[model samples]
Target chain A: MKTETTIQGLTASLASARSSKKMIGFVPTMGNLHEGHLTLVRAAKKICDVVVVSIFVNPIQFGVGEDFDSYPRTLEQDSRLLAEVGCDIIFAPSVEQMYGTQPRLTNISVGQITDDLCGKSRPGHFDGVAVVVTKLFNIVQPDYAFFGQKDYQQLAVIRQLVQDLNIPLEVIGVPIVRAEDGLALSSRNGYLTPEQRAIAPKIYQLLKQAEQQLRQGEMLEQVLANISTELTQAGFVVDYVEARQTNLQPIAQFDQDLVLFVAAKLGSTRLIDNLQINFKT
Target chain B: MKTETTIQGLTASLASARSSKKMIGFVPTMGNLHEGHLTLVRAAKKICDVVVVSIFVNPIQFGVGEDFDSYPRTLEQDSRLLAEVGCDIIFAPSVEQMYGTQPRLTNISVGQITDDLCGKSRPGHFDGVAVVVTKLFNIVQPDYAFFGQKDYQQLAVIRQLVQDLNIPLEVIGVPIVRAEDGLALSSRNGYLTPEQRAIAPKIYQLLKQAEQQLRQGEMLEQVLANISTELTQAGFVVDYVEARQTNLQPIAQFDQDLVLFVAAKLGSTRLIDNLQINFKT
Candidate 1:
């Protein structure tokens, strides 16, 4: 597989494939790819005539005081893993290449849904995602873009962005890849210490328990409070434990498709996980 | 020439042209078939293989009570005009088709430059333009898009938006098309009564005089004040008369390419005009 760094170079590589009407599948990820990202790439390979994986750790997505500087950069190892997965092109652009010396004047804001859940705590976070994803979508012009469902809000934000802007492409959400102990795979998971890593699976476990309790007709607020208390007791500085509909709208009582989301800090590493549950009533 | 009223129809119409490696040119308008718009189309025809004109009276771009409901939409006449000018396709989707029942969650905001000039008076105006233009650009997927420099700040905004978003298309700004008397042609000119129409050309006249004075070593503020006073005395409720660099940054003294901008109301019709002057020094 060929690797290109500049936008021109990437577009040049895709020109012949595009001219021939090849179905281009794209997977955009912050570098330091793990099993979750590979799953997205493998899925793309199964469907597309050409698969492009973009590995740029977007700086704008990180809030001030967030881990923008310490974010992993394992290009050499990441390239090997992507090659193994048969990625046709690996686009790795420097920060300067993506967002030049000039301040980016364009900002894309996805409303309403962005004001709740992860968006509520991390202000302007989804706007950064929306704008950067828009740039990536335009640059790559992919037929299909695969995003891991681990970033459930981000996937939803992208979906809404694509729809609202009428960007002519399909957005495919891949199920989250997890470790044997059920820790959702993420590049940020690398920030966890060994002990913190051991406790990471508890996030998914709480989501699962929350899902089961909701299924058993427990009160929504009670279930949420119980999960929050349990997570706090487990030494996590609980950020949020809430239940919402697929659209991120708060559910009064789980009567439709629901996602139970949880975020907490295990030391310096903030971990997030969600479980989707379809209610039949 | 094909007239498509839906996004799908327009895409289907252009698919073959796109696959056959034809260069697509786009001109987005609100469809009153003015000379200024036709000049843009003519410019596109000269540079592109297929010219697609989108006649969308974008509601979002109009501020509340700013003539959106009463804006001239002469599709039948506009289509005739386009065909006469060798236009290939006219994509005119309805507001319902463009926006749909769902709320458009996406908003594209361009900063700094949008905080002044037309943007300052009409808040969220450039943002609306930015979002709709983005949508149209994606839908048409043209190799180049044309805009009239009549709305100088708008052209600037689109140019900045395209660059910041890395949209893979060229934005060509066609010079303002005007009547023999020098009123910049606009669909809103339809709002002017005969007496108001008679005085409309004065907007352009003032801009021209201001440009000449600034070139002849007139103080920037003095020239702007003179133009505003002249326009007000000529029966206009002057909005603003200012000078700025092409990038819309305020210029204390003209040392680079500059634009003298004017906006005023003749009766109830608000008219705007600008004249570009290249500074030799």
Candidate 2:
């Protein structure tokens, strides 16, 4: 697989690929790869002639006091995994390469959608995500971009951005790839201690349980409160446990497609996960 | 010339154009075509195989009291002029067609540069411009986009947006097309009474005179004050008369590329003009 570290180099490569009428698929990630990321790459490879994966741990997306410095950087292993998964191009740019020496003056902000969920916990985080993703989208100009549903709010934000900006690309959100115990795989999973790792799956478990309860005609608010209580009892500092429509709009009554989202801190590491509940199904 | 009022029609047309490897040059305007807008079209025609012009009098760019509803849109005349100028496509989408039924949630904002000049008078104007231009840029995917330097701050804003967003297009700023009497051509110039038309040229004249005074070692603040006073005395409500770097950076001392900008109200119709000064030569 070809690896490009500069925007110019990637553009030149993509220009050649485009001229030959290749359908490019892009999967943007922060370097430390897992099954989840590989799944996105695999999905891209299935439908596209060229699958491009970008591994730049976007500094702007991490909030103050977040694990920006300690975020894992296993590039050698990551590239090997990407190659194994048949990713055609790997764009692994340095922070300085992704963002130049000068400060950037342009920002893309998606309102309403970014005011809740992960956005509530991390201020300016989605704005940072919006800008960087926009930059990458413009750089790659991919035909299709793959994103894992593990970051559900981010997926929604990206969808909103593409629609509002009229960016010409399809965004496909792949289902969350999880550990055998139902722990949603995340780069931050690497930060969890062995004991915390054992407990991490409980978050997903409770989310599933909440979905079941809602399906079985339990009250939404009561089920959410019980899950929050259950997480708090299990030593996790729960941020929020709420049910909303697939569009992230608050649901007064569960009559449509709904997703239950969770964010909590087990220790220094914060984790987030969600589950889509389709009533029609 | 072919006219597309729907995004799908334009995208499909552009897609076919792209398959043929035609270079697209785009000129986005508020219609009511004048010599200034036509000059941008002429510039686009010289370098590109396809010249596409979009006439959108974006409501988002106008403030509460601004002339959004009253904005002149001469589609029939505009298309005739575009055809005369050999424009390949005219994209004059309806407001609903461009924005859809829902409210726009995404905003593109350029900082620092947008906080001054016209931005000071028309709040959120550049943000509106940035979003619409970004939408148009993505829609057309033009190889080159043209803008007139008459709206100096806007040219700077567009350049910033392209750079910051990493949009793949060259933004070529054409010099302001002027009337024989030296008044900068503007669609808003249509609002001027015949008497006001005679007085409008003075705004451009004063900018040229200010450029000369600065080149002759006049104090920057004093020169600005003189221009403001002169305009005010000539039955105009002077908005601002200032000299700054060509990039709109405040110049404490005139040692670099400078531009003198003026915005004034002549009996309810506002006029703006600028003149670039080269000191290095």
Candidate 3:
């Protein structure tokens, strides 16, 4: 796979691909790839003639106390994995390369949808995501973009952003890739200690139980409280446990498309995961 | 010329043009076409194979108690003028067609530059302009988009937006078109009575005079004050009269690319104009 560190180089490469009438697919990631990111790449490869993957641990997305400096960077291993998956190009730009030394003046923000779930705990996180993703979309000018459902709120935000901005591209969300123990794959998972790693799967297990309780016609609030209590009892510091519509709007009943979202700290590593539950009734 | 009121129709038409390798030039306007708008259209026609013009009197740009209800719209006449100029398509979408019933959640905002000039009088005006222009840019996907320099702050905002968003299109600013009397051409010019119309020329004349004084080493603040006083004395309610850099940053001296901007009300009708100044020293 070809690796480009500059926007100019990537655009020149993509221009050649476009000239040949190839449909470009983009997958943007914050480095330190795992099975989840590879799944997105594979999905892009399946539908698009050319797949471009961008790996930049965006500084602006991390909050003041968050892991901006400590975020892992493994470009060598990441590129090898991408190449093995038949990726066309990897755009691994430096922070200065992506965002110049000059302060940025333009900001793209989506309201309402960014006020719940992960957005509540992480202020300005979705805005950072929105701006960087917008930059990526423009740089790649892709016909389609692949995103993992693990960042469910982010997926919804991107969808809303594209529609609101009139950006001409399709956003496809691949299903969440989980471990055999039901733990969602994340780059942050690398930070988990052996003991914390053992307890990580419990977070997903509780979400599944919450889904089952909701399916069995339990009260939404009761199910949420129960899960939050269980997660805390299982040695996890729960940030939130809530049920909402797929669009991130609060849903009191499961009559529509529902998503059970959870963000918790197992030791020092913050892990976020969600499950989309469909109710037939 | 083909007219499309729907986004799908325009995209479909542009898609065919793209397949045939035709370059699109776009001119976005707020109906009631004047020589200024036509000049932008003419500029687009010269460089591009397909020229598309969109007339949207964006409501969000107008502040509360602004002239949104009375904003002049001459679609029939605008269409005739566009056709006469050999325009390829006219995209005049309705408010509902563009925004739909749901409120827009996404906003594109540019800082610093938007805090002065028209942005000061009309709060949230540039943000509104930024959002709509961004939407228009995405919808048209033009190779080259044209704007008149009559709205100098707006032109600057668009330039910044394009750079910040990484939008892949060249924004060409055509010089401001003027009436023989030195009054800048504007759709809002129609709101003026014949007397007010005759008085409007003085606004541009004073701006030119200010530019001359600044070039001859007159103090920036004094020149601005004199012009504001002159405009207010001439039966006009002066909104702002100031000199600044081309980027809308405050200028302490006439050492760089300077612009003299004026916004005034002549009997209920507001007019704005700017003149870019170059100092030899």
Docking class of 3: high
Per-candidate RMSD vs. true structure? 1.2, 1.1, 1.4
Which candidate, 2 or 3, has the higher TM-score?
2
* Model 2 per-residue lDDT tens digits across residues B1-281: 89999999998888877988899999999999998889999999999999999988898999998999998878999989999999999999998988889878999899999887789999999999999999999999999999999999999999988988889999999999899989999888889999888888888788778878877898888888988998988889998787788888888564788888899999878899999888888
lDDT of each structure? 0.91, 0.91, 0.90
Which window of 10 residues has the lowest lDDT sum in candidate 2 chain A? A248-257
A114-218 per-residue lDDT for model 2 (tens digits): 898889989999999999999999999999999999899999999999998899999999999999999999999988899999889999899989978888999
What local lDDT score does residue A227 receive in model 1, on the 0 to 100 scale? 88
What tens-digit string does per-residue lDDT give for candidate 3 at B39-97?
99889989999999998999989999999999988899999999999899999899988
Candidate ranking under lDDT, highest first, comes to 2, 1, 3
- Per-candidate DockQ versus the true complex? 0.92, 0.89, 0.86
Off by over 4 Å in 1: A252-254
The 10-residue segment with the lowest total lDDT in model 3 chain B? B245-254
- Estimate TM-scores for all models: 0.98, 0.98, 0.97
Question: What would the per-residue lDDT of candidate 1 be over residues A193-223, giving only the tens digit for each residue?
Answer: 8989988898889888888887788888898
Report the lDDT of model 1 for residue A25.
100
Q: Stretches of candidate 3 above 4 Å error?
A: A252-254, B252-254
